[model samples]
Target: MDLKETHISELLIAGNIDAVKTLTQQAVDDGCSAQDILEKALLPGMDIVGQRFKACDMFIPEVLRSAKAMHGAMSILRPLLIASGVPMVGALVIGTVQGDIHDIGKNLVAMLFEGAGFKVVDLGADVKPETFVQAILDHQASVVGLSALLTTTMPRMAEVIQAIKAAGLREKVRIMVGGAPVTADFAFQIGADGFAPNAASAIEKAKQLV
Candidate 1:
């Protein structure tokens, strides 16, 4: 089969790992740059997968499979992509707030940021404020992304922001918050520098805020 960009994306979505690897390698061998395969095929395919996931048209299994396919292709392209001189946009530390075990949003945002060329340090779910502060200190990150899927845990977002501010890291770092129940106004109320409705917008908001 012809390994067009669309075809490559379809293979990714279908979770045809071997097919994806073969087609992606073929695309590379056919005089296509790995970056072209990444930007045109893999990243765009993940974008669609994420959107479908958000819309409930696709579930976690499909998303994970697509991510796996993307990962496979990226493993082959990393050195080439790095040598092509695409600099990282910035570094980020991300986590779901304390008491919140929901990480789907956090994971999505992490993926989007990575695709957007930002180096992300994921702190995982149920992260305490001190954990985030420690991550910031350790990573020396420019942006901190907080995700909370529950209203009860939403307050922890503010707490984390406050802790960061109290530790004198607030001025140096940009704080961005997201999750189902969070609003722009709440972001302001909680002293967050930025807010986004979802992962894509979170990536855009991070760019703007940083």
Candidate 2:
């Protein structure tokens, strides 16, 4: 990798949003392709973030900051990537389940997925089972994430999964579940492919799922 790519990776890991954008543009001006910048710089930086977060060396706020920096760089590079026909890792459909209005965790997972290079289709909060099923079909998503902060809403995750199966789409996408009240045991009982305890694990699990 070029020195600029290495610098971009360092700046992104440091969560230097402004520097990330500036250097990404400079890399482009210096003849670095957007795909090259994404693969060599941004993705590597986020990969480190994932590793550190999994190891507890990094916390949620710090990970979020790095994600923000990644977004800043992507703002300059995503259009170019699109124009160059660069494909994303995969599409992900995510939402806070029905009867659950809290989206903090779901939103964080979405951002982390985006930082990890997935094309995320976020359905926001209070999402119905059918909505999740349709979003999976609509996006042709490779993964689906269900979130619920309340115990009452946790059952909705299972319902959503069942809906996917009813629609004959359950086999098409890997399902993941998370939230304050969700556990891996519950996720397994519900037939989910994975469970994410936090944002970093969400990225890791999604990677494995894909």
Candidate 3:
């Protein structure tokens, strides 16, 4: 990494939102492209945050702070990225399945996906199966993520998957499932393409699926 890019990465990991914003702007003023800043600094910083979170070296609060820093930089870069026709890694449609009002986990995963450079369309909690299908089709999303915190609600994930298949949209998108009661076995049984135990792993899984 360039020295300035390395500094930006460190600042991002440290959750220095203001510093990240300032340095990113400076980098732009110094003639660095938005894509270069994202690839070399912002994304690398979030990658470290993900690794640390997975290793238990960082907790939710810390990871959230890092995510905030990344968002700060993205606020500046998003329009530029659009203007430059820079494509996101992938687009994802995520929601907590119907009958499940729980959303903290889903929200965290959405944030992590955004930080990892994916365009995320969050449908919030208590989402219907048809809503997931519509969002996937509307966004032309590559992946669909389902979250269900209760065992009772877990079956809703299967319903969503079934709905996608019934609508002939299954082949167009990869389905990933997770939540407190979700397991890899359950995900497989439901015919989901991938499973994640937590938000960090969700980003990795989404990347692989895409």
Best by TM-score: 1
Higher-TM-score candidate of 1 and 2? 1
lDDT of 3 by residue, 1-210 (tens): 264534999998888889989888888877788778877787678778878987999897887777787877877876666565334788999999898876656876776677677888999999999999899989999999999978999999999999999999999999999987799999999899999998779978887888
State which candidate, 1 or 2, has the greater lDDT. Answer: 2
RMSD for all candidates, in order, please.
4.7, 7.0, 6.6
Residue ranges of candidate 1 with Cα displaced over 4 Å: 1-86
1-210 per-residue lDDT for model 1 (tens digits):
234634988888777777788878778778788657766787667668868988999997877777777767766766565455435888899999999887756876776687678888999999999999999999899999999978899999989998998889999899999988899999999889999987668877888887
Output the better candidate (1/3) by lDDT. Answer: 3
lDDT of 2 by residue, 62-136 (tens): 888888888788778756754653347999999999998776558767766776778989999999999998888
Alpha-carbon shift of residue 138 in model 1 (angstroms): 0.7
Write down the TM-score of every candidate: 0.63, 0.61, 0.61
lDDT of each: 0.82, 0.84, 0.84
Candidate scoring better on TM-score of 1 and 3 = 1
